[model samples]
Target: MTFKHALMAATLAALVGNAFAAEDRMPPIPADKLSDAQKKSIELLSEGAPAGGAPRNVGAGPWVPLLRSPELLNRLQRMGSYLRYESAFDPRLSEFVILLTARDWSNQYEWLAHQKLALKAGVTPAVTQAIAEGRRPTGMTADEEMVYDFIDELLRNRSVSDPTYARIKDRFGERGVIDLIAINGYYSMLAAVLNVAQSPLPGGAPQQIPTLPR
Candidate 1:
Protein backbone atom coordinates (compact mmCIF):
# COMPACT_ATOMS: atom_id res chain seq x y z
CA MET A 1 0.00 0.00 0.00
CA THR A 2 1.07 3.62 -0.55
CA PHE A 3 2.35 5.58 2.49
CA LYS A 4 -0.73 7.85 2.56
CA HIS A 5 -3.09 4.89 2.28
CA ALA A 6 -1.31 3.02 5.08
CA LEU A 7 -1.51 6.05 7.39
CA MET A 8 -5.23 6.41 6.70
CA ALA A 9 -5.79 2.76 7.46
CA ALA A 10 -3.80 3.02 10.70
CA THR A 11 -5.87 6.00 11.86
CA LEU A 12 -9.11 4.21 11.00
CA ALA A 13 -8.06 1.17 13.00
CA ALA A 14 -7.22 3.33 16.03
CA LEU A 15 -10.67 4.95 15.94
CA VAL A 16 -12.35 1.57 15.79
CA GLY A 17 -10.28 0.34 18.73
CA ASN A 18 -11.24 3.36 20.81
CA ALA A 19 -14.88 2.87 19.95
CA PHE A 20 -14.75 -0.68 21.25
CA ALA A 21 -12.82 0.34 24.35
CA ALA A 22 -15.36 3.00 25.21
CA GLU A 23 -18.45 1.13 24.05
CA ASP A 24 -20.04 1.00 27.50
CA ARG A 25 -21.33 4.55 27.69
CA MET A 26 -22.28 4.22 31.34
CA PRO A 27 -18.94 3.49 32.88
CA PRO A 28 -18.95 3.19 36.66
CA ILE A 29 -18.94 6.30 38.75
CA PRO A 30 -15.85 6.64 40.89
CA ALA A 31 -16.47 5.91 44.57
CA ASP A 32 -15.90 9.52 45.48
CA LYS A 33 -18.48 10.67 42.96
CA LEU A 34 -21.21 8.24 44.06
CA SER A 35 -24.26 9.87 45.55
CA ASP A 36 -25.70 8.78 48.89
CA ALA A 37 -28.44 6.86 47.11
CA GLN A 38 -25.98 5.25 44.75
CA LYS A 39 -23.88 4.14 47.69
CA LYS A 40 -26.88 2.66 49.46
CA SER A 41 -27.96 0.92 46.31
CA ILE A 42 -24.53 -0.66 46.07
CA GLU A 43 -24.98 -2.07 49.53
CA LEU A 44 -28.38 -3.49 48.69
CA LEU A 45 -27.14 -4.91 45.43
CA SER A 46 -24.19 -6.58 47.12
CA GLU A 47 -26.21 -7.87 50.04
CA GLY A 48 -27.60 -11.05 48.56
CA ALA A 49 -27.93 -13.51 45.70
CA PRO A 50 -30.18 -11.34 43.63
CA ALA A 51 -30.07 -12.83 40.18
CA GLY A 52 -28.50 -15.87 41.88
CA GLY A 53 -25.50 -13.78 42.93
CA ALA A 54 -24.97 -10.06 43.00
CA PRO A 55 -22.02 -8.79 41.03
CA ARG A 56 -18.79 -9.00 43.04
CA ASN A 57 -18.44 -5.38 42.04
CA VAL A 58 -21.53 -3.26 41.45
CA GLY A 59 -19.96 -1.87 38.27
CA ALA A 60 -20.64 -4.88 36.09
CA GLY A 61 -23.07 -5.45 33.23
CA PRO A 62 -26.51 -3.80 33.52
CA TRP A 63 -25.72 -2.88 37.11
CA VAL A 64 -23.27 -0.14 36.09
CA PRO A 65 -25.83 1.96 34.27
CA LEU A 66 -28.64 0.80 36.51
CA LEU A 67 -26.77 2.14 39.54
CA ARG A 68 -27.57 5.61 38.27
CA SER A 69 -31.18 5.14 39.28
CA PRO A 70 -30.56 3.58 42.65
CA GLU A 71 -34.15 3.06 43.78
CA LEU A 72 -35.10 1.62 40.43
CA LEU A 73 -32.10 -0.64 40.56
CA ASN A 74 -32.99 -1.81 44.04
CA ARG A 75 -36.55 -2.65 43.05
CA LEU A 76 -35.60 -4.26 39.78
CA GLN A 77 -32.93 -6.37 41.41
CA ARG A 78 -35.38 -7.62 44.00
CA MET A 79 -37.81 -8.61 41.29
CA GLY A 80 -34.97 -10.28 39.43
CA SER A 81 -34.01 -12.17 42.57
CA TYR A 82 -37.43 -13.74 42.76
CA LEU A 83 -37.72 -14.36 39.06
CA ARG A 84 -34.30 -15.90 38.72
CA TYR A 85 -34.13 -17.91 41.92
CA GLU A 86 -37.64 -18.32 43.22
CA SER A 87 -39.50 -18.81 39.98
CA ALA A 88 -41.11 -22.16 39.39
CA PHE A 89 -39.21 -23.05 36.25
CA ASP A 90 -36.08 -25.13 36.55
CA PRO A 91 -32.68 -23.43 36.13
CA ARG A 92 -32.31 -24.82 32.65
CA LEU A 93 -35.65 -23.46 31.58
CA SER A 94 -35.02 -20.08 33.17
CA GLU A 95 -31.75 -19.71 31.33
CA PHE A 96 -33.38 -20.90 28.16
CA VAL A 97 -36.00 -18.18 28.41
CA ILE A 98 -33.29 -15.62 29.08
CA LEU A 99 -31.34 -16.74 26.02
CA LEU A 100 -34.42 -16.50 23.89
CA THR A 101 -35.04 -12.95 25.02
CA ALA A 102 -31.42 -12.02 24.47
CA ARG A 103 -31.44 -13.36 20.94
CA ASP A 104 -34.79 -11.81 20.12
CA TRP A 105 -33.39 -8.45 21.06
CA SER A 106 -29.97 -9.18 19.60
CA ASN A 107 -28.55 -8.14 22.92
CA GLN A 108 -24.98 -9.40 22.77
CA TYR A 109 -24.12 -8.74 26.40
CA GLU A 110 -27.08 -10.69 27.74
CA TRP A 111 -26.48 -13.59 25.38
CA LEU A 112 -22.79 -13.73 26.25
CA ALA A 113 -23.58 -13.67 29.95
CA HIS A 114 -26.40 -16.22 29.91
CA GLN A 115 -25.47 -18.69 27.17
CA LYS A 116 -23.03 -20.43 29.49
CA LEU A 117 -25.50 -20.43 32.35
CA ALA A 118 -28.07 -21.93 30.02
CA LEU A 119 -25.66 -24.68 29.00
CA LYS A 120 -24.50 -25.25 32.55
CA ALA A 121 -28.12 -25.42 33.60
CA GLY A 122 -28.43 -28.18 30.97
CA VAL A 123 -29.66 -26.46 27.83
CA THR A 124 -28.01 -28.42 25.04
CA PRO A 125 -25.33 -26.92 22.79
CA ALA A 126 -27.38 -27.84 19.76
CA VAL A 127 -30.39 -26.02 21.20
CA THR A 128 -28.39 -22.88 21.96
CA GLN A 129 -26.72 -22.93 18.55
CA ALA A 130 -30.06 -23.11 16.82
CA ILE A 131 -31.46 -20.25 18.89
CA ALA A 132 -28.33 -18.21 18.15
CA GLU A 133 -28.81 -18.81 14.44
CA GLY A 134 -32.51 -17.84 14.51
CA ARG A 135 -33.73 -21.32 13.68
CA ARG A 136 -36.04 -23.57 15.66
CA PRO A 137 -33.89 -25.81 17.81
CA THR A 138 -34.21 -29.55 17.29
CA GLY A 139 -33.98 -32.26 19.95
CA MET A 140 -35.29 -30.20 22.84
CA THR A 141 -37.15 -32.14 25.48
CA ALA A 142 -40.94 -32.01 25.40
CA ASP A 143 -40.80 -29.42 28.16
CA GLU A 144 -38.13 -27.38 26.41
CA GLU A 145 -40.12 -27.32 23.22
CA MET A 146 -43.22 -26.18 25.07
CA VAL A 147 -41.35 -23.36 26.77
CA TYR A 148 -39.62 -22.45 23.52
CA ASP A 149 -42.80 -22.31 21.54
CA PHE A 150 -44.58 -20.24 24.14
CA ILE A 151 -41.75 -17.72 24.40
CA ASP A 152 -41.09 -17.67 20.68
CA GLU A 153 -44.68 -16.88 19.90
CA LEU A 154 -44.93 -14.30 22.64
CA LEU A 155 -41.81 -12.47 21.52
CA ARG A 156 -42.80 -12.47 17.88
CA ASN A 157 -46.50 -11.74 18.13
CA ARG A 158 -46.53 -9.79 21.39
CA SER A 159 -49.30 -12.12 22.53
CA VAL A 160 -49.72 -15.81 23.01
CA SER A 161 -52.50 -17.78 21.42
CA ASP A 162 -55.08 -19.49 23.58
CA PRO A 163 -53.74 -22.91 22.67
CA THR A 164 -50.15 -21.95 23.40
CA TYR A 165 -51.10 -20.37 26.71
CA ALA A 166 -53.20 -23.39 27.63
CA ARG A 167 -50.40 -25.81 26.79
CA ILE A 168 -47.96 -24.12 29.15
CA LYS A 169 -50.54 -23.56 31.86
CA ASP A 170 -51.66 -27.19 31.82
CA ARG A 171 -48.11 -28.45 32.17
CA PHE A 172 -46.72 -25.96 34.67
CA GLY A 173 -49.82 -24.49 36.29
CA GLU A 174 -50.80 -20.82 36.32
CA ARG A 175 -47.92 -19.79 38.53
CA GLY A 176 -45.47 -21.52 36.28
CA VAL A 177 -46.92 -19.84 33.24
CA ILE A 178 -46.68 -16.45 34.86
CA ASP A 179 -43.17 -17.08 36.04
CA LEU A 180 -42.15 -18.12 32.57
CA ILE A 181 -43.61 -14.95 31.08
CA ALA A 182 -42.11 -12.86 33.83
CA ILE A 183 -38.60 -14.14 33.14
CA ASN A 184 -38.95 -13.37 29.47
CA GLY A 185 -40.29 -9.89 30.14
CA TYR A 186 -37.68 -9.10 32.75
CA TYR A 187 -34.80 -10.08 30.49
CA SER A 188 -36.40 -8.34 27.56
CA MET A 189 -36.40 -5.07 29.50
CA LEU A 190 -32.77 -5.49 30.48
CA ALA A 191 -31.85 -6.30 26.93
CA ALA A 192 -33.54 -3.10 25.78
CA VAL A 193 -31.59 -1.05 28.28
CA LEU A 194 -28.27 -2.70 27.42
CA ASN A 195 -28.85 -2.33 23.71
CA VAL A 196 -29.83 1.32 24.08
CA ALA A 197 -26.75 1.98 26.18
CA GLN A 198 -24.64 -0.10 23.80
CA SER A 199 -23.27 -1.86 26.86
CA PRO A 200 -20.00 -3.66 26.22
CA LEU A 201 -19.15 -7.05 27.58
CA PRO A 202 -16.72 -7.13 30.50
CA GLY A 203 -12.98 -6.88 29.77
CA GLY A 204 -13.53 -6.03 26.14
CA ALA A 205 -14.70 -9.55 25.36
CA PRO A 206 -15.67 -9.92 21.75
CA GLN A 207 -19.37 -9.50 20.87
CA GLN A 208 -20.98 -12.79 19.89
CA ILE A 209 -24.26 -11.70 18.33
CA PRO A 210 -23.93 -10.12 14.92
CA THR A 211 -26.03 -7.04 14.26
CA LEU A 212 -28.95 -7.85 12.04
CA PRO A 213 -29.35 -6.10 8.70
CA ARG A 214 -31.54 -3.04 8.88
Candidate 2:
Protein backbone atom coordinates (compact mmCIF):
# COMPACT_ATOMS: atom_id res chain seq x y z
CA MET A 1 0.00 0.00 0.00
CA THR A 2 1.09 3.61 -0.57
CA PHE A 3 2.61 5.34 2.48
CA LYS A 4 -0.12 8.04 2.61
CA HIS A 5 -2.94 5.47 2.34
CA ALA A 6 -1.38 3.37 5.14
CA LEU A 7 -1.10 6.40 7.48
CA MET A 8 -4.74 7.42 6.81
CA ALA A 9 -5.98 3.90 7.54
CA ALA A 10 -3.99 3.79 10.77
CA THR A 11 -5.47 7.14 11.88
CA LEU A 12 -9.00 5.94 11.15
CA ALA A 13 -8.38 2.78 13.14
CA ALA A 14 -7.16 4.82 16.13
CA LEU A 15 -10.27 7.02 16.08
CA VAL A 16 -12.58 3.98 15.99
CA GLY A 17 -10.72 2.42 18.92
CA ASN A 18 -11.09 5.58 21.01
CA ALA A 19 -14.79 5.84 20.25
CA PHE A 20 -15.42 2.25 21.27
CA ALA A 21 -13.45 2.69 24.46
CA ALA A 22 -15.55 5.68 25.48
CA GLU A 23 -18.91 4.17 24.51
CA ASP A 24 -21.52 3.76 27.21
CA ARG A 25 -21.59 0.30 28.79
CA MET A 26 -25.37 0.18 28.49
CA PRO A 27 -26.81 2.59 26.01
CA PRO A 28 -30.25 3.89 26.90
CA ILE A 29 -33.23 2.53 25.02
CA PRO A 30 -34.18 5.14 22.50
CA ALA A 31 -37.34 7.02 23.28
CA ASP A 32 -38.85 6.55 19.83
CA LYS A 33 -38.68 2.78 19.83
CA LEU A 34 -39.93 2.15 23.39
CA SER A 35 -42.38 -0.70 23.99
CA ASP A 36 -45.84 0.05 25.40
CA ALA A 37 -44.61 -1.06 28.82
CA GLN A 38 -41.55 1.12 28.58
CA LYS A 39 -43.61 4.10 27.55
CA LYS A 40 -45.97 3.58 30.45
CA SER A 41 -43.11 3.44 32.88
CA ILE A 42 -41.84 6.77 31.61
CA GLU A 43 -45.28 8.26 31.93
CA LEU A 44 -45.60 7.11 35.53
CA LEU A 45 -42.13 8.31 36.39
CA SER A 46 -42.77 11.68 34.80
CA GLU A 47 -45.98 12.15 36.72
CA GLY A 48 -44.25 11.64 40.06
CA ALA A 49 -41.11 13.52 39.24
CA PRO A 50 -40.53 16.70 41.23
CA ALA A 51 -41.93 19.92 39.80
CA GLY A 52 -39.75 20.82 36.83
CA GLY A 53 -39.42 17.39 35.19
CA ALA A 54 -38.13 13.89 35.57
CA PRO A 55 -34.53 13.65 36.61
CA ARG A 56 -32.05 13.80 33.74
CA ASN A 57 -30.74 10.37 34.57
CA VAL A 58 -34.17 8.69 34.66
CA GLY A 59 -34.04 8.04 30.94
CA ALA A 60 -30.71 6.25 31.30
CA GLY A 61 -31.09 5.05 34.85
CA PRO A 62 -32.32 1.78 36.29
CA TRP A 63 -35.79 2.61 35.10
CA VAL A 64 -34.75 1.73 31.55
CA PRO A 65 -33.70 -1.85 32.23
CA LEU A 66 -36.63 -2.10 34.60
CA LEU A 67 -38.90 -1.24 31.69
CA ARG A 68 -38.79 -4.90 30.69
CA SER A 69 -41.04 -5.58 33.67
CA PRO A 70 -43.41 -2.64 33.89
CA GLU A 71 -45.31 -4.09 36.82
CA LEU A 72 -42.18 -4.41 38.91
CA LEU A 73 -41.09 -0.94 37.83
CA ASN A 74 -44.44 0.47 38.90
CA ARG A 75 -44.19 -1.04 42.36
CA LEU A 76 -40.59 0.06 42.76
CA GLN A 77 -41.49 3.56 41.65
CA ARG A 78 -44.22 3.82 44.27
CA MET A 79 -41.96 2.45 46.95
CA GLY A 80 -39.16 4.76 45.88
CA SER A 81 -41.47 7.74 45.92
CA TYR A 82 -42.54 7.01 49.46
CA LEU A 83 -39.03 6.37 50.64
CA ARG A 84 -37.74 9.55 49.03
CA TYR A 85 -40.61 11.97 49.66
CA GLU A 86 -42.82 10.59 52.39
CA SER A 87 -40.50 8.63 54.64
CA ALA A 88 -40.71 9.23 58.39
CA PHE A 89 -37.04 10.12 58.49
CA ASP A 90 -36.25 13.70 57.62
CA PRO A 91 -34.76 14.44 54.21
CA ARG A 92 -31.30 14.87 55.68
CA LEU A 93 -31.21 11.41 57.14
CA SER A 94 -32.70 9.86 54.03
CA GLU A 95 -30.10 11.50 51.86
CA PHE A 96 -27.38 10.29 54.17
CA VAL A 97 -28.49 6.71 53.74
CA ILE A 98 -28.56 7.22 49.99
CA LEU A 99 -25.03 8.52 49.93
CA LEU A 100 -23.83 5.64 52.01
CA THR A 101 -25.44 3.18 49.63
CA ALA A 102 -24.01 4.99 46.62
CA ARG A 103 -20.53 4.84 48.08
CA ASP A 104 -20.87 1.22 49.01
CA TRP A 105 -21.77 0.32 45.45
CA SER A 106 -19.30 2.71 43.83
CA ASN A 107 -22.30 3.92 41.88
CA GLN A 108 -21.23 7.02 40.01
CA TYR A 109 -24.63 7.97 38.61
CA GLU A 110 -26.39 7.58 41.95
CA TRP A 111 -23.72 9.60 43.69
CA LEU A 112 -23.93 12.34 41.07
CA ALA A 113 -27.68 12.61 41.54
CA HIS A 114 -27.74 12.55 45.37
CA GLN A 115 -24.51 14.25 46.47
CA LYS A 116 -25.96 17.71 46.09
CA LEU A 117 -29.31 16.76 47.51
CA ALA A 118 -27.50 15.24 50.45
CA LEU A 119 -25.73 18.53 51.07
CA LYS A 120 -28.91 20.54 50.62
CA ALA A 121 -30.68 18.27 53.07
CA GLY A 122 -27.95 19.09 55.63
CA VAL A 123 -25.44 16.25 55.48
CA THR A 124 -22.19 17.99 56.26
CA PRO A 125 -19.46 18.23 53.67
CA ALA A 126 -17.00 16.51 55.94
CA VAL A 127 -19.28 13.52 56.38
CA THR A 128 -19.96 13.17 52.68
CA GLN A 129 -16.27 13.49 51.88
CA ALA A 130 -15.35 10.91 54.45
CA ILE A 131 -17.94 8.49 53.17
CA ALA A 132 -16.69 9.00 49.61
CA GLU A 133 -13.18 8.17 50.82
CA GLY A 134 -14.40 5.02 52.61
CA ARG A 135 -13.67 6.39 56.09
CA ARG A 136 -15.86 6.97 59.11
CA PRO A 137 -16.79 10.62 59.18
CA THR A 138 -15.94 12.80 62.15
CA GLY A 139 -18.32 15.17 63.95
CA MET A 140 -21.59 13.38 63.26
CA THR A 141 -24.55 14.42 65.36
CA ALA A 142 -25.80 11.78 67.76
CA ASP A 143 -28.56 10.80 65.37
CA GLU A 144 -26.25 10.83 62.36
CA GLU A 145 -23.72 8.69 64.14
CA MET A 146 -26.34 6.16 65.10
CA VAL A 147 -27.57 5.96 61.51
CA TYR A 148 -24.08 5.74 60.08
CA ASP A 149 -23.14 2.95 62.41
CA PHE A 150 -26.37 1.09 61.84
CA ILE A 151 -26.10 1.15 58.06
CA ASP A 152 -22.37 0.45 58.08
CA GLU A 153 -22.92 -2.64 60.16
CA LEU A 154 -25.92 -3.72 58.15
CA LEU A 155 -24.01 -3.51 54.91
CA ARG A 156 -20.85 -5.10 56.23
CA ASN A 157 -22.31 -7.70 58.56
CA ARG A 158 -25.74 -8.14 56.97
CA SER A 159 -27.33 -7.66 60.38
CA VAL A 160 -27.23 -5.10 63.14
CA SER A 161 -25.71 -5.97 66.47
CA ASP A 162 -27.90 -6.16 69.57
CA PRO A 163 -26.59 -2.86 70.87
CA THR A 164 -26.97 -1.12 67.53
CA TYR A 165 -30.50 -2.44 67.14
CA ALA A 166 -31.41 -1.36 70.66
CA ARG A 167 -30.00 2.10 70.15
CA ILE A 168 -31.94 2.69 66.94
CA LYS A 169 -35.08 1.09 68.27
CA ASP A 170 -35.01 3.37 71.28
CA ARG A 171 -34.47 6.51 69.25
CA PHE A 172 -36.66 5.87 66.18
CA GLY A 173 -39.35 3.46 67.41
CA GLU A 174 -40.43 0.30 65.60
CA ARG A 175 -41.91 2.05 62.56
CA GLY A 176 -38.89 4.24 62.14
CA VAL A 177 -36.64 1.23 62.38
CA ILE A 178 -38.63 -0.49 59.66
CA ASP A 179 -38.48 2.60 57.48
CA LEU A 180 -34.75 2.84 57.94
CA ILE A 181 -34.27 -0.72 56.86
CA ALA A 182 -36.56 -0.17 53.92
CA ILE A 183 -34.62 2.87 52.77
CA ASN A 184 -31.36 0.99 53.02
CA GLY A 185 -32.69 -1.94 51.06
CA TYR A 186 -34.31 0.25 48.45
CA TYR A 187 -31.23 2.33 47.76
CA SER A 188 -29.02 -0.75 47.78
CA MET A 189 -31.26 -2.22 45.12
CA LEU A 190 -30.90 0.95 43.08
CA ALA A 191 -27.14 0.82 43.44
CA ALA A 192 -27.15 -2.69 42.08
CA VAL A 193 -29.28 -1.63 39.14
CA LEU A 194 -27.06 1.31 38.31
CA ASN A 195 -23.90 -0.70 38.73
CA VAL A 196 -25.14 -3.55 36.60
CA ALA A 197 -26.28 -1.27 33.83
CA GLN A 198 -23.16 0.88 34.10
CA SER A 199 -25.39 3.93 34.07
CA PRO A 200 -23.66 7.09 33.01
CA LEU A 201 -23.94 10.44 34.68
CA PRO A 202 -25.86 13.14 32.82
CA GLY A 203 -23.99 14.80 30.02
CA GLY A 204 -20.93 16.74 31.20
CA ALA A 205 -21.27 15.52 34.77
CA PRO A 206 -18.25 14.15 36.58
CA GLN A 207 -18.19 10.93 38.60
CA GLN A 208 -18.48 12.05 42.20
CA ILE A 209 -17.95 8.69 43.90
CA PRO A 210 -14.45 7.19 43.67
CA THR A 211 -14.05 3.42 43.61
CA LEU A 212 -12.54 2.20 46.86
CA PRO A 213 -9.27 0.29 46.72
CA ARG A 214 -9.46 -3.31 47.86
Candidate 3:
Protein backbone atom coordinates (compact mmCIF):
# COMPACT_ATOMS: atom_id res chain seq x y z
CA MET A 1 0.00 0.00 0.00
CA THR A 2 1.01 3.65 -0.35
CA PHE A 3 2.69 5.55 2.50
CA LYS A 4 -0.37 7.65 3.44
CA HIS A 5 -2.65 4.69 3.38
CA ALA A 6 -0.35 2.74 5.68
CA LEU A 7 -0.27 5.51 8.28
CA MET A 8 -4.03 5.81 8.32
CA ALA A 9 -4.24 2.10 8.83
CA ALA A 10 -2.07 2.30 11.95
CA THR A 11 -4.33 4.92 13.51
CA LEU A 12 -7.33 2.91 12.46
CA ALA A 13 -5.87 -0.02 14.32
CA ALA A 14 -5.40 2.02 17.49
CA LEU A 15 -8.96 3.29 17.30
CA VAL A 16 -10.50 -0.06 16.46
CA GLY A 17 -8.50 -1.64 19.26
CA ASN A 18 -10.30 0.59 21.73
CA ALA A 19 -13.74 0.42 20.15
CA PHE A 20 -15.09 -2.33 22.38
CA ALA A 21 -13.48 -0.97 25.55
CA ALA A 22 -16.30 1.27 26.75
CA GLU A 23 -19.01 0.75 29.33
CA ASP A 24 -21.40 2.86 31.47
CA ARG A 25 -18.36 3.56 33.64
CA MET A 26 -17.53 6.21 31.09
CA PRO A 27 -17.02 9.58 32.78
CA PRO A 28 -20.03 11.81 33.36
CA ILE A 29 -20.26 15.38 32.08
CA PRO A 30 -22.81 16.37 34.74
CA ALA A 31 -24.69 18.33 32.09
CA ASP A 32 -24.00 17.71 28.42
CA LYS A 33 -20.85 19.63 27.56
CA LEU A 34 -18.80 20.08 24.38
CA SER A 35 -19.40 23.13 22.22
CA ASP A 36 -20.86 22.46 18.82
CA ALA A 37 -17.47 23.03 17.20
CA GLN A 38 -15.83 20.47 19.48
CA LYS A 39 -18.54 17.92 18.81
CA LYS A 40 -18.19 18.33 15.07
CA SER A 41 -14.42 18.27 15.23
CA ILE A 42 -14.48 15.11 17.27
CA GLU A 43 -16.79 13.54 14.78
CA LEU A 44 -14.58 14.56 11.88
CA LEU A 45 -11.52 13.27 13.71
CA SER A 46 -13.09 9.85 14.19
CA GLU A 47 -14.32 9.58 10.64
CA GLY A 48 -10.68 9.03 9.54
CA ALA A 49 -7.57 11.16 9.77
CA PRO A 50 -6.17 13.21 6.91
CA ALA A 51 -2.68 13.44 5.42
CA GLY A 52 -1.02 15.73 7.96
CA GLY A 53 -1.99 19.15 9.44
CA ALA A 54 -3.52 19.59 12.92
CA PRO A 55 -3.75 16.75 15.37
CA ARG A 56 -6.14 13.86 14.93
CA ASN A 57 -7.84 15.00 18.12
CA VAL A 58 -7.19 17.63 20.78
CA GLY A 59 -9.94 17.42 23.36
CA ALA A 60 -9.34 17.83 27.08
CA GLY A 61 -9.34 14.79 29.37
CA PRO A 62 -10.77 11.50 28.15
CA TRP A 63 -12.15 11.15 24.63
CA VAL A 64 -13.85 8.69 22.40
CA PRO A 65 -11.18 7.35 20.05
CA LEU A 66 -10.80 10.10 17.47
CA LEU A 67 -9.96 7.55 14.81
CA ARG A 68 -12.89 5.30 15.58
CA SER A 69 -14.71 6.39 12.48
CA PRO A 70 -13.22 4.86 9.37
CA GLU A 71 -13.11 8.09 7.36
CA LEU A 72 -11.37 10.51 9.74
CA LEU A 73 -9.22 7.81 11.23
CA ASN A 74 -8.08 6.77 7.78
CA ARG A 75 -7.12 10.33 6.88
CA LEU A 76 -5.02 10.84 10.01
CA GLN A 77 -3.49 7.41 9.80
CA ARG A 78 -2.17 8.38 6.35
CA MET A 79 -0.65 11.60 7.62
CA GLY A 80 0.91 10.08 10.71
CA SER A 81 2.49 7.23 8.78
CA TYR A 82 3.67 9.36 5.89
CA LEU A 83 5.54 11.78 8.15
CA ARG A 84 7.08 8.96 10.12
CA TYR A 85 8.07 6.84 7.13
CA GLU A 86 10.51 9.14 5.38
CA SER A 87 13.60 7.62 3.74
CA ALA A 88 15.93 10.57 3.01
CA PHE A 89 17.08 11.50 6.50
CA ASP A 90 19.04 9.12 8.64
CA PRO A 91 16.46 7.45 10.86
CA ARG A 92 18.58 8.50 13.83
CA LEU A 93 17.97 12.12 12.90
CA SER A 94 14.26 11.48 13.03
CA GLU A 95 14.54 10.09 16.55
CA PHE A 96 16.71 13.01 17.60
CA VAL A 97 14.11 15.43 16.32
CA ILE A 98 11.46 13.59 18.28
CA LEU A 99 13.60 13.45 21.43
CA LEU A 100 14.47 17.10 21.21
CA THR A 101 10.90 18.29 20.88
CA ALA A 102 9.66 15.94 23.56
CA ARG A 103 12.28 17.32 25.91
CA ASP A 104 11.69 20.94 24.98
CA TRP A 105 7.98 20.62 25.54
CA SER A 106 8.48 18.84 28.87
CA ASN A 107 5.98 16.29 27.72
CA GLN A 108 6.26 13.21 29.87
CA TYR A 109 4.57 10.79 27.49
CA GLU A 110 6.50 12.02 24.50
CA TRP A 111 9.77 11.94 26.41
CA LEU A 112 9.14 8.51 27.81
CA ALA A 113 8.21 7.06 24.44
CA HIS A 114 11.10 8.64 22.56
CA GLN A 115 13.76 7.91 25.16
CA LYS A 116 13.81 4.24 24.31
CA LEU A 117 13.47 4.98 20.65
CA ALA A 118 16.40 7.38 20.88
CA LEU A 119 18.56 4.78 22.58
CA LYS A 120 17.58 2.26 19.98
CA ALA A 121 18.42 4.84 17.36
CA GLY A 122 22.00 4.68 18.75
CA VAL A 123 21.88 7.76 20.99
CA THR A 124 23.92 7.22 24.13
CA PRO A 125 22.30 6.89 27.53
CA ALA A 126 23.78 10.14 28.87
CA VAL A 127 22.60 12.03 25.82
CA THR A 128 19.17 10.46 25.98
CA GLN A 129 18.86 11.39 29.65
CA ALA A 130 19.99 14.93 28.92
CA ILE A 131 17.50 15.26 26.10
CA ALA A 132 14.77 13.84 28.29
CA GLU A 133 15.62 16.35 31.05
CA GLY A 134 15.73 19.33 28.71
CA ARG A 135 19.41 19.78 29.37
CA ARG A 136 21.79 20.61 26.55
CA PRO A 137 23.72 17.37 26.44
CA THR A 138 27.47 17.71 26.27
CA GLY A 139 27.43 14.04 25.51
CA MET A 140 27.52 14.04 21.74
CA THR A 141 30.60 13.23 19.68
CA ALA A 142 31.85 16.10 17.53
CA ASP A 143 30.16 14.65 14.44
CA GLU A 144 26.98 13.94 16.39
CA GLU A 145 26.69 17.42 17.87
CA MET A 146 25.56 18.77 14.51
CA VAL A 147 22.24 16.95 14.75
CA TYR A 148 21.73 17.77 18.41
CA ASP A 149 22.55 21.41 17.79
CA PHE A 150 20.09 21.54 14.93
CA ILE A 151 17.33 20.25 17.17
CA ASP A 152 18.37 22.60 19.97
CA GLU A 153 18.33 25.58 17.65
CA LEU A 154 14.82 24.77 16.52
CA LEU A 155 13.66 24.29 20.09
CA ARG A 156 15.10 27.68 21.03
CA ASN A 157 13.92 29.77 18.09
CA ARG A 158 11.30 27.64 16.41
CA SER A 159 13.48 28.42 13.42
CA VAL A 160 17.16 27.96 12.63
CA SER A 161 19.88 30.57 12.60
CA ASP A 162 22.03 30.92 9.50
CA PRO A 163 25.14 29.25 10.94
CA THR A 164 23.20 26.29 12.30
CA TYR A 165 21.18 26.07 9.15
CA ALA A 166 24.34 26.05 7.06
CA ARG A 167 25.85 23.30 9.17
CA ILE A 168 22.72 21.19 8.94
CA LYS A 169 22.61 21.79 5.21
CA ASP A 170 26.20 20.69 4.87
CA ARG A 171 25.65 17.60 6.95
CA PHE A 172 22.18 16.37 6.15
CA GLY A 173 21.56 18.12 2.82
CA GLU A 174 18.21 19.74 2.00
CA ARG A 175 15.99 16.70 2.28
CA GLY A 176 17.39 15.83 5.71
CA VAL A 177 16.67 19.27 7.12
CA ILE A 178 13.12 19.22 5.81
CA ASP A 179 12.64 15.73 7.18
CA LEU A 180 14.05 16.84 10.51
CA ILE A 181 11.68 19.79 10.68
CA ALA A 182 8.76 17.58 9.77
CA ILE A 183 9.85 15.13 12.46
CA ASN A 184 9.77 17.84 15.10
CA GLY A 185 6.50 19.30 13.87
CA TYR A 186 4.90 15.88 13.82
CA TYR A 187 5.86 15.21 17.43
CA SER A 188 4.86 18.70 18.50
CA MET A 189 1.38 17.96 17.26
CA LEU A 190 1.47 14.70 19.19
CA ALA A 191 2.63 16.41 22.37
CA ALA A 192 -0.21 18.87 22.12
CA VAL A 193 -2.79 16.15 21.73
CA LEU A 194 -1.30 14.03 24.51
CA ASN A 195 -1.06 16.97 26.91
CA VAL A 196 -4.51 18.41 26.26
CA ALA A 197 -5.98 14.94 26.51
CA GLN A 198 -4.06 14.38 29.74
CA SER A 199 -2.94 11.06 28.35
CA PRO A 200 -0.53 9.62 30.87
CA LEU A 201 2.81 8.11 29.97
CA PRO A 202 2.41 4.98 27.85
CA GLY A 203 2.17 2.65 30.84
CA GLY A 204 -0.65 3.04 33.32
CA ALA A 205 1.40 4.65 36.09
CA PRO A 206 1.52 8.43 36.26
CA GLN A 207 4.79 10.26 35.82
CA GLN A 208 5.51 13.96 35.97
CA ILE A 209 6.61 15.97 32.97
CA PRO A 210 10.00 17.47 33.72
CA THR A 211 9.95 21.15 34.61
CA LEU A 212 11.51 23.45 32.03
CA PRO A 213 12.44 27.12 32.42
CA ARG A 214 10.47 28.06 29.33
- TM-scores of all models? 0.86, 0.83, 0.63
Worst 10 residues of 2 by lDDT: 48-57
- lDDT of candidates 1 onward, in order: 0.82, 0.79, 0.59
- TM-score of candidate 3 relative to the true fold: 0.63
What is the per-residue lDDT of model 1 for residues 84-157, given as tens digits with 9 covering 90 to 100?
A: 88899988999999988888887878888889999999999999988876668999999999999999898778
**How many clashes in each candidate?**
0, 0, 15
Q: How much is the lDDT of residue 151 in candidate 1?
A: 96
Candidate 2, backbone clash total: 0
lDDT of 1: 0.82
> Model 3: per-residue lDDT, tens digit, 72-150?
5345555555665543555465676777877766666666655676688787888876665555687686546877777
Better of 1 and 3 by lDDT: 1
Candidate 2 wrongly placed segments (more than 4 Å): 1-25, 49-57
Candidate 2, residues 124-168, lDDT tens digits: the string is 999998888777899998999999999999999999999999988
The model with the greater TM-score, 2 or 3, is 2
Which candidate number would show the highest lDDT if scored against the true structure? Answer: 1
Query: Which of 1 and 2 is ahead in TM-score?
Result: 1
What does the lDDT read for residue 141 in candidate 3?
A: 69
